[model samples]
Every structure is written in structure tokens, then in C-alpha cells.
Target: MSDICVIIAAYNAEATIAQAVTSALAEAEVAEVVVVDDASSDATAEAALAASDGSGRLIVERQAQNGGPSAARNRAVALSQAPRIAILDADDFFLPGRFARLDPDLDLAADNIVFVTPEHAARLDPTNLPAAPREVEMLDAERFALGNLAQGVHRGELGFLKPVMSRAFLTRHGLRYDERMWLGEDFDLYMRMLLLGARFGLTRAVGYAAVQRGASLSGRHRTADLAALEACCRAHLEMPASPATQEAMRRHLRQVQAKLLLRQFLDRKAEAGLGAALGFALAPPARFLPIAKGVARDKIAALRPPAPPRAERFLLPV
Candidate 1:
């Protein structure tokens, strides 16, 4: 258990599974690569077999029946014996030094891998690169979580974009991806980790190359997706937090519910949609205290000259 185990959940990814396996094997920090095939009715398994460099560490588990990404990943993790698990979708590959960039620092120091399309990954010249996984910055926990989930409560970005969870940490908490959820399962896992006080920081490295992107199977199930998303939001609202954080969660819930109502009208979804609409419609409005005693006093701050700009920008382009 001294090395990292790379887990890849591949489904009907015959065309890209090879590169993914190869990439994982390329990582010096990776001791083994587990590729779980979700009963693909194609050559996904065969491609994985063909792609192996015969290091005897690439374990390919081909399921008998089609289960889902969650089930596939769970199976892979169950068979692995590494302390850290780095996940890669079949259509994604680890950029060089991905494993090298990721460091172990208890619950923090996770990787900061970027998602690059197939076309995007092809233009780089291996001979003259800035070196794989160049570390750049650290991330704030709450801010990272909020920004990661900015897309939606059930969606996340950077902090969790490429999770490399500590095996001991997960096992101790009895935590695993929600197999029941067809979509937003990652969101659920991240939220649960955050609630339980998992502090995630960035390696500012371990960038990976995602060969392709498209709508997920759950994306087509708008009703189910929204329901899952709402469940995620409610879970957040129930968690202990400061007044400001709770208010932000409330505002997010309102926005989600409003959309659920409209989707219900167009898709004629189940009772869930109607319930969300009613919940938002009947919710009380929020009030905030004024910052200043006088309007003129408030305007004084706004009228002041802007602070001097720094040469270094606060945000880095992803």
C-alpha cells in the first residue's frame, strides 16, 4: 500500500481506453492501474488488454453485466490495496507527472488536474514542455468548495475535478460513491466529504487530458437530474454553517427550485417538480441589516478612489 492505485471506470470506450491505461501506467507514482469495464458490449476490455505494457500491475476487471460508473469504480477500489486512489474516466488520460505532482498531506494537498479535450492534448510537444504537473498555488477550502460547486450544487470543478482520495480516510468513514445515483454522484461524494470536514487543497498540478466530452446519460433524464440536484441542495442547507453560508445555500435552493418548476411545466415531470415549485413559492423573503447609519455615509465609501492595482492578478486562468 505504499503506492497509488489508478482506477479507471471505462464503458464502451474501446477507442480511448488504451491511451488511458497507458497514461496511468506512465505515472511513476502509480504502483498499479485498475481498469473496470462496465460490461461494455464492445472491445473496451480487449483494448485494455492490448494496451497493457505487461508490467503485471494493470488489473482489468470486466463485469458480467452493465452496472454503472459508480458500481464499476466501487469494484475497482475494492480490489485495490493502495493508500491513494486516483480516478480516470476511460476517455481521459493522465498527463505526464500526474502522480508526481500529487503529494500526501493527510486530508489536504489533492491534485489540481485540468480537463483537456482530445484536440487540446495533441498540440503539446513532449520534447519542450514546462515539465509535467507544474505546481502553481494552494486553494482555500470553503472558497474552493463554493467555486467548485458553482456550476450547481450537484456539480463541481477544480478542488474535486480529479479526486485522489486517501483509501484509509474513505474506509474509516465508510464512504463510497452513491451507486444509486445515476448522476450527480460526484457532487454527493464531495458534499459529504465537505460536511464531514474534509479539507481539500490543490497540488496546482497533476493535470490530465480528457479525450472527449459530451452529455452524460443522466443529463438526458432532466427530471431525475433536477431531483438529484435538489436533494444535494437540501443536504447542504441541513448542514451546520454560519449565517452567511446558510443564506447562500438558501438562495441557491431557491434558484434550483425555480428551474425545477419550469422544467416540470415543459417535461410534465412527476410530483417532485410540483413539490419544488410549491416550496419556493411559499418560502419567506430574506432581510439584511444595513451597513451604514446614513445613505450619505454608505455613498462615501463608494465615492472613494479605487485601491492601487497590483502587478500580479488574483486569479489564474484554468
Candidate 2:
């Protein structure tokens, strides 16, 4: 059996920390569960510790200052001694038998995720989850980059996946989460690994439940974060890849740049005035469409009734 250490990076997650810690400890294949409280003002570290089973399998580390999720996760990885590493977000958790579904041979393995609200997650029965046929897909750098492309308001992009990775592989390649990035950090790390010849496998097994909350931290990204993501995407273009992969990188970079511009335009408008923002937005005619299109999309989306939250299990077909 492969011993896996689950790393959780938390920030003000006291209300949900215990559940995340408990669920990780429930899996027999999980040798350790490490929760790094990223300088949360709340009782997050205490809550994580209280969830320990007293078997010395849970370790809660508190950051001296808030360093974002990437830094916290990198710290957890360094502290953990397990052969395999899996990331479980403070707001998300694994279902039973999740570790058993992992492919030990692959450098990275991801499983299908079921999106649930907190209310729906609380009602889930681990032993009686909806049955889904298992399927496996091997992912290369090209496939991963292309899959991460966001199409208007789509819910499940490959970028959202959480995967288990081989610690040895990470150490051998000297790879860690880019501490500079909080947005799309997972996608950036995974793409870099794949480029380095890491074997990434995705299985259609429903063993992870990702809680979709009412107000998501992802929903509110600062302009700096978007700019960082755009820079990261640009860096990937310099790596050696097939033509298809290069094209995908170009497309993804363009998307990130567009989002960054839109964010900057909005920020300037808020800080300065509409005249200043319009001047920046329309100076380059090419920039106007992406910003205008994004604004129009959001406006239209707001007019429509919000989609009812899923009351039942809805496993994403990865």
C-alpha cells in the first residue's frame, strides 16, 4: 500500500477545518493528514487539532503569517515524510476509498470530483455513493493545457482538479507550487510537471467531493493575482513543446491576458473614473472587445435566474 500524506492549506477555515481533517484521517491508506493554518485569525489550528484521532496521524502546523495557499501547501509538503502527497483543500474533502483508487505507478493521479454544496455534502453517505463506471485517461502537457481553457461560465475545467503526486518525483525535479501564485497555482504546477515528463493519469472514480460554497474565494481575485497568472502562462510558452502544445499555450496565454486586462480596466474605473478606464480600455481597439465582452457576459448572466444548486451527487466526467 502506498502511504499518502494529505496536505490542507487553510485560511480562516475554522468552521470547516474539522470536517476536512476528519475525512482525510478516515482513509486507511492515508498515513498522515497535515493541515497548515495560514495565519488564520480564527481558531483554525485548534479546530484541526481537535479533529485528530489521537493516533498521531494528524499534524497541524500554523503559519506565523498569512502566505496564501501555495506557500502553506509547500510548507506542508516539506514537513510531510510520506512517499505520496495529496492535496485536500480546507473547504474540500475526500470520500471513502479515495486513496485506494490512486495509481501508485503514475507520478500524478487525479480522480473525478463530485461537486456538492455544504448541505449536500453533509447528507452524503460514504458507503452508498452513486455508482459510476470507472474510466482512466492519461494526460500529457498538451491535453492539460488545452483542457484548462475556460469557456464562458463553465463550472468544471481541468484546472480545478486536485491530484495525488509522487513525493520522490517532485523532489527529483525540484518542483514545488509557485508561491507567487494563488490563482491557478494547481494548474501551473501540474502543467510544469507534465512538461518534465511526469505521468499524469485521471480516473473516473467518484472519491472526492469539492464543496461549492455560496461565496467562493476564487470568485474574488485581485488584479495582482490575475496579472501573476498571465505572467505564469507567458513563461510556459518558452518551454520546449510540440506545435499543438505551443498553440495551446498561446491560446491559454491570450485568455489569461484578456482576463488580466479586464480586471485592470475595472480596477482603474473604480479607483479613477469611467473616463480614465475608458481611455485605457479603448486606447487599443483590440482590448475593448475582451473587456466589453466580459462585462456584457456578466451583465447577461446577472439577469438570468441563478441555477439551483445541485441537491444530488453530480460527479464531473474528467
Best by lDDT: 2
**Candidate 2 wrongly placed segments (more than 4 Å):** 312-315
- At residue 270, what lDDT does model 2 achieve? 97
Q: How much lDDT does each candidate structure score? A: 0.65, 0.87
Tens-place lDDT per residue, model 1, 115-162, is 444565666433343334355344433454456444522223543366
lDDT of 1 at 297: 41
- Give per-model TM-scores: 0.74, 0.96
TM-score of 1: 0.74
lDDT at 147 for candidate 2? 84
lDDT of 2 at 310: 74
lDDT tens string, model 2, 1-318? Answer: 639999999999999989999999998888889899999999999999999999899999999999998999999998999999999989888888888877888999998888888898888876676566666789998888888888654455788888899999999999999999988999899988988899999888788888888667776788989988888888888888899999988988988888888899999899999999999999888899999988897789999998887765454643
Model 1: ten consecutive residues of lowest lDDT: 285-294
